[model samples]
Target: MVIRLAIVFVLTFVSCQEENDIAAKNILGIGRMQAVAVSGRLICNGRPATNVKLKLYENEILFDRLMEESRTDSNGQFRVSGSKREISRIDPKLNIYHKCNYNGLCYKKFTIKIPKDYINNGREADRTYDIGTLNLANQYPGQSTDCIN
Candidate 1:
């Protein structure tokens, strides 16, 4: 009877009760998933943009599932969650999105290369990675190409 009670206690502690209102406001589950905080500059017209909407992408698709977005402050700097460190440390993935309207308007999405083992200095957490600066130009409108340098 003691052993049965102990096992039940352990199970209760480790389970994620999402459907059951599991810690309703809890940001992340106890399972193996990544956590990220992202910020950077979205250069509009070669300068820090104001109220520029940002988007994140994954698997060549962009939406609610694989993306998080934020606006750049007056400094033209912003951040977003990039990846999870503890669960998938080696596979760091970051895709920054931008949209500009000029000469018929153009929108583009670019991928930033981040290797595993890269640590974010700001977070001081080993599981986080940085996708540096993302600059967008309206030279070629609406060409959703993966920008890499």
Candidate 2:
């Protein structure tokens, strides 16, 4: 009887702790907007990689939140800026989806982690990170096939 009672008490405490953790996370995710910006050029085999899709996301534990998206212009240049409201510091990352060498049905995807120093505390980004020119024909680390961006 004592063991059963202790188990019940432990479960109850654990449940309450879980609820409090969830509440804290919800509160932290609700406000305190932060912003970031990124720009880069994509090249494929010495040519401009136009119309390549680029997205900036706030990397999270459960799921990443999309902040902004854009496509490479005629000159293979893209600029994306976005903001998210969260009390905790934001983890900004950029995703590139393109088909340069692979002839598969889905596009090749790669990720670039933005440094924390570039994240601003307001809605507008103070500075933009230039990733420089990338040749999509070359294989990059963590590259994968992504049908959905």
Candidate 3:
């Protein structure tokens, strides 16, 4: 009877350890790294808009909060990362600051809405969502745009 009791205790300990391991992975994002990867090229007119400031924001009802930021490289390419928990709550947006003009109209800042489904939400391990190329141009007459900055 003592031997059977010992075996049962060991099995319980092992089961708890397994559960703790999974919980740790989920909380620390060990196996779920790279929850959201936003990468794209910033183009203004016909040339690469290099050295532009890019900011990531979570669009909420009351206000939009900035999460991460990155600058465009020499080729106007940028990449930014965010956690699943922060991005899953609200819609993500990419804000760009540049001096782009079209037909005598210029915009110093612009925003791009990121699709909600693009975020992994920690369900998939090592997932990356490519937002593709972002072509930023000045607004024409009667053209609607979202600018914050």
Candidate 4:
């Protein structure tokens, strides 16, 4: 009788713990996100030709999903971030670019979403997140190129 009672108590405690965990994690589903946009001369007709207004796209939807937007600096640089909670789910775009070479001239948008399981797995995920940079095709050079610097 004592053994059965103890088992029941243990099970009850575990179930309650699981319930608590679920409750705690539910509040942060979106995940925190941030991004930087940049534009530069890429051997355009030998000399740099000022690219016109180019709209950068992330997640391939439209010009609305971006959490933040910035005009390119004098050197053509921009960064956007969509803040969301960091949990077991997929996070928002880290960086967004509008007008790869120029702005408002048939703008092309790009989004970068990374596989962030670190919140749940911890250290193990760091290796992947650090080993390289996450590259999404929509960027200026597309997926064919990779940069982690």
Listed in order, each prediction's TM-score against the native is: 0.47, 0.80, 0.57, 0.30
lDDT of 4 by residue, 1-149 (tens): 99999999877755554335445555644333333232332222333223222232334222223334444344333332233223334343434333333434343444344444422322122222321222222244342211220
Provide the lDDT at 49 for model 2.
98
Q: What is the C-alpha lDDT of each candidate?
A: 0.48, 0.88, 0.64, 0.35
Ten residues in a row with the worst lDDT in model 1? 57-66
lDDT value, candidate 4, whole model: 0.35
Q: Report the number of backbone clashes for model 4.
A: 27
The per-prediction CA RMSD against the true structure, in angstroms, equals 9.8, 6.3, 13.3, 13.7
Please, what are the lDDT tens digits per residue for candidate 1 over residues 105-141?
Answer: 4435555544535534332335534444445664333
Ranking of candidates on lDDT, top first: 2, 3, 1, 4
Candidate 1 wrong stretches, greater than 4 Å: 1-31, 57-64, 82-92, 100-106, 118-134, 138-149
Best by TM-score: 2
TM-score sort, best first: 2, 3, 1, 4
Best by lDDT: 2
- Global lDDT for candidate 2? 0.88
Q: After superposition, how far is residue 53 of candidate 2 from its true place, in Å?
A: 0.5
Q: List the residue pairs that clash in candidate 2.
A: none
How far out, in Å, is residue 84 in model 1?
6.2
